[model samples]
Target: MINIVYVESSLELVPSEIIRHPSVRRNAKRKGKPPEENLLDRSLHHWAMDRLDNSEKRGRPDIIHFLLLEALGSPLNKTGELRIWIHTVQDLCIYVNPEARLPRDYNRFKSLIEQLYVDGRSPPNGDTILLELRKININQLRDSLNPDFVIGLTSRGEPSSFETLSKSLCDFNNPMVCIGAFPHGPYQKETASIMNKQINVYPEPLEAWIVNSRLIYELEKCLNVYNSQKIL
Candidate 1:
């Protein structure tokens, strides 16, 4: 199986330092939840987020939402050839079950993530767990996967085509691709340190979801998950 890890994703609950800010408090009140229970959202808590370092790149759970929707809804994932994981900025690793059907509505998605944070797993009392959260960093996650190869996709890396990258990946029993889930900024030092190799698929930077779509499509092609005859 090919593992897709979204590293340093900007998905987390409101930090204790800013949980009591007016913006966070009012948003929590509006949603009938405690400030600490809400997800840190730049859209709703921009004024308060400004106080945090790297404020521009934080508080973006939407990036993770879009990336997950793209990766989970692909033929690669459907064929059981793909595994998805999220390593958040807070050093939390979110394991995503292949069968998980995330909510398409953004508000509902946010609510589900908040619930995951509180319960440590989704469907809190179900026999099957769709999502699970753990207190592990990127390095630990990489070691746990023990993939044959680990690659990080970033604008600063050596330029390559997705076709070439996918072809190389097909030669391995299990390979992992790391993509940044934040809006702006380079991969954290800890994340960059674990990459077996780093590559740039495009000259200009692309949105995380766009990169996911392109990468998954190329991988599907290389793995024969989709073919010309099938479409016609």
Candidate 2:
């Protein structure tokens, strides 16, 4: 039920889209360096690592979100000029318990949507987007899908994640969203409990996707034949 996947930016994506991480910026400044430099820069990496080490030394939570990309020599590789796109999630992590070990190395714990994309724009000639939309419609036609709970991941509680997800909400009900390194103020207690179990504070990458797929499958089973006819 758990789906672990990897996602890489298409060649059309701009390289700068990845290097603008707050963790990278703040760390860059402490070392008397410019934050504009990419993490790939030897000087920048050393400076960022030093800053991270310093934070750990001071007992400040050093939560980081690692953006995974394809390694060099892969046949699908398309990056040219040694572009940097992995630092986009520099300082993003959830904290279910303040005293718990600050979740570091988030890169090692991310779930990718294989062959899926995050960019808003669809593929060339609008065919790819149309095809995807058709697939969703087709899936709905084949089964009943209604999710009972929904959990969301937002980098710094940004409204964009909600906005982007809302566009797809027609597929499910009002599910809960886990924002930032912390749960919402009202749902903190319940959210914390969920995080502790399946999520592992922020839902381990593998577990999170598995839960997502299960929810979808369950929703499908719950659909009524009458409702299905109406939607289709």
Candidate 3:
């Protein structure tokens, strides 16, 4: 199994900084609506009025939402061999089930994120993609997975050609890969200490979606995810 971790991700409650931004104010100013009401009128409005102070705003977790859409959707999840553990900057590690399908709908994903913010976990409705929630750090998470090999993807690491990625991971039965889900930030120190190797799949820095897609694609090929004739 090739498990992935998105560490120090920007999946936090909308900081007060952004909630009061001028752009958000302008949007809320329309019809003299409150910020939350304006942003969430058509949205799921999972955040209760009483709890808006503690509610999470969904900007950065959007990356993970897209990642889940790519990694855990449809026939890929049917393979039942992939796991994506998102370790947020707030120190909540969410394990997503490959067997459970995440909604492709943006509003649905936003609802899920809002719930994660309010409840510190997703409601277990069986179909929900969230598998587990743990109060742990990046180092502890890696140790918990205990994969035979650990690889960290970074823009500044040793260049790993795309052609060789599948072959590189194929040698290990259990390999855990990690990507920084934030736009641009320094990785936590523990992330470096926990990784067995660090590499950049692209010569230039790529967005999280591209990096994650390429890695998961190569991983699926290595696992023969869709090969009806081959057994995992």
Candidate 4:
């Protein structure tokens, strides 16, 4: 199986320091939840986020939302060849079950994640786990997965095509691809240290979901997931 890790993703609850801001308060009131229960979203909390550290690269759960929708709906995931994990900026790791059908609506996605934060897992009492949160950092996750290879995707890495990268990945029993899910900025120092090698799939920077789609398509081709269909 191939592992896809979204590192340092900007998904978290409103920080205590900014929870009382008018923007956060207003959004929380509209959502019928405490300010602290709502996800820290740049669209609804931009004014409040200005005072937080790394404002440019934070409060972007939408990035992960788009990425999850693309990935979970893809053939790679359907074949059970893909495993996904979200490593948030707050150092929380979310394990996504392949069977998990995430909400298509962004607001519902946000609410689900917020509840996961509160209950530590969705359904909170079910035998089957759809999504689960753990207080683990990127380094710990990397070590735990222990994939044969760890590839980090960054604009600063050696340039290559998805076809070539997918071929290289096939040589290993298990390989993990780490993609930055933040809107801006580089990988955190701890996340960077875990990469066996870094790769640049495109000459220019692309959004996280775009990289995810192209990469998964190429991987599916490599794994013969679409063997009966014309890929042209």
Q: Which candidate is the best by lDDT?
A: 1
lDDT against the true structure, each candidate: 0.92, 0.26, 0.67, 0.91
* Higher-ranked by lDDT: 1 or 2: 1
Per-residue alpha-carbon lDDT of candidate 4 for residues 118-152, written as tens digits (9 for 90 to 100): 99999699699999999888888988999999999
TM per candidate comes to: 0.96, 0.23, 0.76, 0.96
Candidate 2 lDDT at 122 equals: 24
Q: What is the lDDT of residue 228 in candidate 2?
A: 43
Candidate 4 lDDT: 0.91
Candidate 3 structure quality by residue, lDDT tens digits, 1-232: 6778887675654344455655556655753645543323213223332244323323355677777777776344556666678887666788776555667886577566666555555674454545566788887887788899888888888888755876787788888888887767556676678888888888788988888888777767766777744333
Cα lDDT of model 2 by residue, 1-232, tens digit = 1111111111111124333555556655664444442222322233444433212221111111221112112111121111111111122111111112212343222111111123222232443331111222211311221224434342222233222343333354433333222111222232233321122222223332333334333333433222343221
- Model 4 ranges off by over 4 Å: 228-232
Model 4, C-alpha of 131: deviation from truth (Å): 0.5
Where does candidate 1 stray beyond 4 Å?
227-232
Deviation from native of the Cα of residue 146 in model 1, angstroms: 0.2
The lowest-lDDT stretch of 10 consecutive residues in candidate 2 is 2-11
lDDT of 1 by residue, 1-232 (tens): 8999999899989988898899899999999999999999999999999889777768999999999999888888888889999999888899999889999999999999999999999989969999999988888999999999999999999999999999999999989999999997898888999999999999999999999999999999898987533321
